[model samples]
Target: MADRLSQVSGHLTNSYGRGLLAGEVAIITGMCWRSWSGIGRSAALLFAKEGAKVVVSDLDEKKAQIVVDEIKAAGGDAIAVGGDVGADDFPQKVVDAATKKYGKINHIVNNAGFTFDRMLHTTPDDAWDVIQKIHVRAPFRLIRAAAPHMRFKVRRENRSVINVSSISGLHGNVGQANYATAKAAVVGLTKTVAKEWGGFGVRANTVAFGFVKTRLTQAKEEGASIEINGKKVALGIPGAKDDPNAQYPHIPLNRGASPDEAAAGILFLASPLASFVTGHTLEVTGGQGI
Candidate 1:
């Protein structure tokens, strides 16, 4: 009798809401930092909150462990693996470490990246190569490393890969030739991966974002930058104010999305809710890019 009453109440309202990813393990890359917290960190936190154990991969060991500690404090499961995505060995290292700890891989969110904006005339060979390696090559290798575990496994459920992109990739942005090229390349790669991996019940998709106020997009007045290898590059948009989107007169939503808001899009694609969604790009820009 009590169980029947509870069921009726649950139907009417919310019954403490079981998480959408109640039984999964996810690998999220590019999660780090003290001031420049971006979509990667937000997505990792949300995924863990949604009942998925997580592997927090980032360039900085200290910052990566910080995210893992936060997840554990919230009663969620997580571990940190620090390595440069641009390194040849890092992708496989991430996969090996994840499988050793979690036993299996269920989701891959390729969110590690940084923008090295430069005009076409001034774009150096090294600059272009770095962006491509981090944004394009890393995603390709990570997904490939995880594919063997996902494909032809009798007990495996549908697995997914979410490649993080930028609005600049969809609609070319000036002064960002290298950054834009790498991002755009991932979209094409994702579409191809979706087709080839579909037979194995694995899905591939992209999430392109507009102005979300991370250190990468914060106003220069905030003193935002990222140290790549050893060089400190100015890593943010200038003159957009603290709320980059709110200051924009053309944005449909009238404000920029918070990190959590941007993360919601990635979380959706990673969850079972998007099991049938592949080869698609979900723009979580609050209608900024149209």
Candidate 2:
């Protein structure tokens, strides 16, 4: 089933031409993960297929370069920028990279983040702070860094800012108190950006995803882990039954989304197709929490 889905996604991507996002420049962060299932990587590839020059950012420099190579091999324009978004200077560096390569930024997809899940009672202070720093503070800083480019004095075209959120933010999740609070703040930040930048023809929105089959959602027993501050932080759900069908019964589709599927939602918001859509949270869950 996964292979078939990949084939279909590849076909549709190849079908895209210089139409929806032609002549646009975009910066998409978090474009790399151990597996090729990062939503940001998918978004970068999809955006490039639609004719957008992409600036792909990720903490893993080598992995990010792989995605950049893939884009260029597909006859798409892209450059890899490696940095930690949690760093104070990294956001400006991303903005600089985009402007330096593409001349200007038209779209910003704040998709660089991770999860450090723990129940409220067990959550550590540093865990909560780091989650907010990565998920909420990073986006805020990136937008602020790109404001001069996007919030132009005399705008020439429609610009977009798509912030990635989660259903956990909208409807709290177990063992995700830190994640939920940070994601909820993301919605407020996006709405404020829309309100402040609407007159400049800049649209800001959020994509609230539910379950997506990425490293973050893979079973913890798989041993996929990310290092944070010298400590190994494990990724994925604990005690997952290893059955997609049995795992997501609450979702109407009874399955988690593929990264490519989630990227489609980000593509729509960044494309001209959603010219008038702003300050909205397009939930990409399979009818979960409805």
Candidate 3:
């Protein structure tokens, strides 16, 4: 029995080591200091583990380099590009960097976005514009810039795009009108691109995440509630999941999703396993808002 168990463990370990994306190249945006275990950092790490050569892009050069360094330390291939996604030149720079480093870009993850918590009535015009520019305008421009390159590759190869959205966009959260509106625009953008680019062997999709532990959540105080679709959902203080108020009673899974879990979904959509899927929004919220 001991020998049999040993053999089984050995097989499992071997199977786990075979890389899923041995020769692919992935471009991940918004991988900066603000991304504390959220979509940006999680996507970068996950893509590297899958054996893809990763390109980490963010406004902060230091933060983007940190992710690249971590991937290299783990024996994975990666590089970093620093630029503002909202800039007109940023999208082209990201694509050029990825192509120069990896020879080709197989996947793109548009995950650069920020949320400012303020009631619509209290939100300043400048804040609203900035939020939309970062969340909606940036992704739209990046995808537009990357699509031609992806289409060119698709004529000779295949590619995918994974846009990160949020439950707030789907259900409409209070004090987050700016964020919700921007995310909803992402969904529309994803669908439109999927249709426009489908003929080129490229797929586009969105991942709408629920509450996850990240710097955005950290900004909120402990035991705060945000209204979703007219229902109140309590948000836990960052790093304090043990607090009873943090528990999501409406979630069928009885817990919030981890960034890794959400990242897995994005990776799947970007993988060959989801070649037939496009223009779809996959919600990774433990069945919340379903």
Whose TM-score is greatest here? Answer: 2
Kindly list the per-residue Cα lDDT of model 1 for residues 126-239, writing each as its tens digit. Answer: 788889989999899998888887776443364788999999899989999999889899999999989998888788999999988777877766666777768777777767
Clashes of each: 0, 0, 0
Clashing residue pairs found in predicted model 3: none
Per-residue C-alpha lDDT of model 2 across residues 27-54, encoded as one tens digit per residue: 9999757644799999999998988899
Indicate whether candidate 1 or candidate 3 has the larger lDDT.
1
Give the C-alpha miss distance for residue 8 in model 2, angstroms. Answer: 30
Cα lDDT, all candidates: 0.84, 0.88, 0.78
Q: Residue 55 deviation, candidate 1, in Å?
A: 0.2
Q: Which scores higher on TM-score, 1 or 3?
A: 1
Error of 2 at 219 (Å): 0.4
Give the residue spans of candidate 2 off by over 4 A. 1-17, 153-156, 241-247
What would you estimate as the lDDT of candidate 1? Answer: 0.84
